[model samples]
Target: MTAMGKVRGYNAGAMLLHWAIALAIILQIAGGFAMMHTQIIPDALRFTTFQWHKTIGLLVLALTLARIAWRLLNPPPAHAPMSRVESGLAHLVHFLFYLLMLAVPLAGWLVVSVSPTAIPTLLAMSPDLPWPHLPLPAAWKGEGVSDLAGTMHAVLAYSTLGLLVLHVAGAIKHSAIDREPSFSRMMPLGRLPRQSTAFLAVPLAAGLAVAFFGGGLAAGRLGPESTSLAVNAAPGESAPAATGASAWTIDKTASSIRYEVAFSGNPIGGTLGRWDAAIAFDPAKPTEGSAKVTVDAASIDVEDAFVKSNVPGPDGFDVAAHPTVTLSVDRFEAAANGFVGHGTMNVKDKIVPLYLPFIFTESDGRAHVTASVVLDRLVLGLGLQNDSTAQWLGKDVTVKLDLFATRAGAASPQS
Candidate 1:
């Protein structure tokens, strides 16, 4: 039998495709919203959803194209001719659906192409296919392409949802009121009427699996490498001088490391400020130096509701009072991938010992540092869990620091 419905309508092939694409679209919609709304889903789950959305979007576009081609080749079963108003409405609706089906992915593709976020090529696959961005050899200069694409994608999503609702409502009206075999137009063939729950269950199960697994893979292990940029060590010259080489003065002009903080229950999340942390080292000796950092706490512009509400940074690292958080490095060690330094992180009225594993690269007599630290929030008394609602906020807060400090002056180790 043909893939479209049975007699006088679409056969099984077309029907199955229709249902499959419908399931994919629904999964994409749900997953997209879920990921946007909360971080509850682990990274793996988040990645999977993103990949699934991309995959399903592409599938919808392909299936729509195939359906169109099939119609051209074999033609849709003739429907009872409608009045002028009905014909116009039907035509407009079908056109809009097709337009959206094609446009949604195109917008997404554009967004991904220009964005630093890598795009996945195959559905449910780990390998990513990098596509070129809009700057066309740096000619189409500006961030405008990426911005426009993202906005268009959001707009198309909502518009398509509305269209889908209208389409379903129209189908139900035709089936119930007109007693038209409209639903049958896309029904499978030879499948006994009122088939067991598997019809719905199988697709539903497959969809859920795909959504979960795909998102997990994408966000978790299977996805591409994290889109993190870093600065590495470059060639440099140094001399052995008494009292060690002079300290590299902190360079405020250099790009400051930036991070985005997310708490489980925090209502707000945004960019934290940049700071200049200088490092002193002996190029000739390699391992002889320290790191000094002074952060302008007042400049820390965060949007996390929890942090905002907890005046003085939970542990009273109050910017209004102290205005700065300082870090003075003691010693450094070379690691397999990078370097590590044991130091003290000083905040308002407290000096906490910290062992920071950091990456250091030297170029032009300057060092760049990118350090990742997961600190026990309880130690700093960032008592984020005050109420029942804040209970979800975990005790460990992950702090990732990426900084570039220039060579300033050197001082003897204070024993």
Candidate 2:
């Protein structure tokens, strides 16, 4: 090693990494606490907060790995003079910080992976980062264990605060009591002696960083194929592979039916996995349009294990007896917002009036459609027998449809 006096400050790369990780950790701690065990923020807003928390936690994990790699190749400045006992304690605190930086996020990731709710962790809550859940087997997922894992994540995260206090106190002690350059050594702008180290020129550092990230993904793949996050279908039932004899052909590949409801004030979104639409409509003559949609009653997947288990029972859709739900529209009327389909929805045995508002656009032979329908689940007796008071599950649910279709003779989008 070079003489201790020769290197008086951390490399620029080390300083940048330190500050970045510190900021991310601080954000995660504050956001994580606000989302858990508190009524500080409204439950509705917590949904967005939960996503922000996850996104920052992942960032901390990434930066921590990078910091570890940087520390390995670039030597840090020497410690301030102190007794052997004091030096050991400082080193131990640092070691624990690094360990928790890795463990806390990993624990959080595990909590999401095994959670019973079907919520996804969209990086930045945007569609861009398409982060996938850690693949784990069915045996590792459920309500009981998910709650326990959540508790562990919270506990591990709170421990970071204790370590932060000790770490800061040590820096202050070195600067104030010992009158040393402990804090200045890591500052970006200071009169401290700067060390010249090949920060990124080292191939070993890059290799270790890659290993750290790739190793985690590889471990997830080793487990059995992850259970479907949101999926529901009855035996022998499946989504149509191609357009049928309807006036328009639905491109199942280019379409989706998603539903959202507020559960305990937090939004729970899901999908109807097995459904098909038959359209006999002409955009040129809006008033002469007609359509019908059939949805497998058992395909109500909200991603809640308890909800899924009971959703097809006597108190819910009663799939064995009802088998399917249908929406039929006899005519469409021109509306300011595009068009409206005055329809009726049949759930089990009840027939309730419904109005679907949607916008439609056609180019060449393909037609694009997007519609939103808000229905009161209570009126239709969905989960009414079990949750009559609208206690856990909210009363109204919004179903969104986005699909692309082609005139019957035109080329199929799926084809």
TM-score of each: 0.47, 0.62
Worst 10 residues of 1 by lDDT: 228-237
Q: Per-residue alpha-carbon lDDT of model 2 for 1-415, expressed as tens digits?
A: 2233543888888888789888888888887877776789786676677777887888788778778878877766676677798889999988999999999988888887787654445567653333456767778876777788888888888898999999899889888777766777888877767877874734565565566556644443342222232333555333333343437888888899998987757778888778888887776686777888889887867754335545666667888788888888888888898889988999989999989989998887888999998999989988775566776678889999998889887887568
Instruction: Compare the candidates by TM-score and give the number of the best one.
Output: 2
Best candidate according to lDDT:
2
Q: What's model 1's lDDT at 170?
A: 73
RMSD of each: 14.6, 8.9
411: Cα error in model 2, Å = 23
User: 296-331 in candidate 1: lDDT tens per residue?
Assistant: 665554443223324333333455556666667777
User: TM-score of model 2 relative to the true fold?
Assistant: 0.62
